[model samples]
Target: MNFGREAMMTSDIECDVRSLGDSGKQRAIFAHFDSLSVGQSLVLVNNRPIEHLRDAFDAEYAGSYSWQELEPRPRSWRVRIGKTASDALPRVVGHTSSGDLDRRSAVWSLPIQRRHDLDVTIVTLAPGTSTTPRPGPAVDTLVHVLAGTGTVTTELRDLDLDPGTLLWLPRHTPRSYTAGPDGLRYLRVRPHQQSPVPDSDGPW
Candidate 1:
């Protein structure tokens, strides 16, 4: 796979908390965690260390998640938060945020991941990059804009995109994407259609 496509396979859902502000940050973090199925995780990329989020986890999800600090610097931090296998189900909650971190991804453009019965595809496009025509069914295919800005072109019309944008792809529909000057990135979630996914092909 090419670099762009290779990047989408990671199990981590990138949540830039800077957009959530001080008041909304924790709720946003909780929403991301709530969106995960058992055994899935979210990688929080933030402007500063978030020890408080850990404390919140202690109160809300104690013994339910495993936390790991990936990068801790004077100016920034990256935390890997994963949900453990549990009898409880994760709710599909809405998210709100402003922005966080001001850097571009170096490797991988689009990565494919499996979170339980769902296939989560992360698509990262460089500025001026456009996707090959993608076909999907309506309703089953859900799209969320994670970062940057872009345009989505369908047979009906062309739409401008920004962070937090949600879109749907209808059955037999084909769509194209183009990244803006800063590049564009989004997550596509859908029901898993095939069986016997290889261990090597599973989410990280």
Candidate 2:
């Protein structure tokens, strides 16, 4: 939720709808919704529950779309409004906290949300620890470093991984991660078309 603007391309369109009040926001939401394809979506960020927006969708797009609450808190109410089949209900609707992190030998990872074309996740690494993400076929991966520092070693070169650093890893690329003295935390965004290829040894 603390990500920079560039990290949230999905929320870029309505960057200023709030200033326009409920009327403006509603117009913007439906306009964006009208522009979506069968699996595309837009992210709406508001501090309050969007009851009116939900009602509008229910009234107009009831059978052709879906709604999922990504963040339900007061200050960060995020909703994913997408164009999906009427029968495709939300499989999960909630947040992923640190407690839900899956502990590996030197890292912890968990899913934030999974929708039609994207899967967001968080990964934390211990200082001095490393990750050997195996090479396999999958969707393109976009990584955003949320905290700390690290080194990403790929077959062709070495790249510094720092806070705010964003990287796009193509499918089947081989890479490894090394946490710095302060440890490392990052967010991974991958396409829903194909799943990420897990590390051959288990952790990635």
Note the Cα lDDT for every prediction shown: 0.65, 0.64
Taking all chains together, the TM-score of candidate 1 against the true structure is 0.42
Q: List the residue pairs that clash in candidate 2.
A: none
Candidate 1: RMSD to truth = 17.8
Over the stretch 1-204, how does candidate 2's per-residue lDDT look in tens digits? 443233345533432354557767777777777676677767777777766667566546656776666667787677767778633344443332342222223233433222245555667777878886667345578888877788988878989999899998888678888888877777776654443655342335
TM-score, per-candidate, Cα-based: 0.42, 0.45
For model 1, residues 1-204, the per-residue Cα lDDT tens digits are 232222322787878887667888877887888888887878887888866678667546657898877766655577778889553245533332222323333222222322346565656677877766655443366778888898988888898988999987765566788888877777767666555534221221
Residue 5, candidate 2: alpha-carbon lDDT: 37
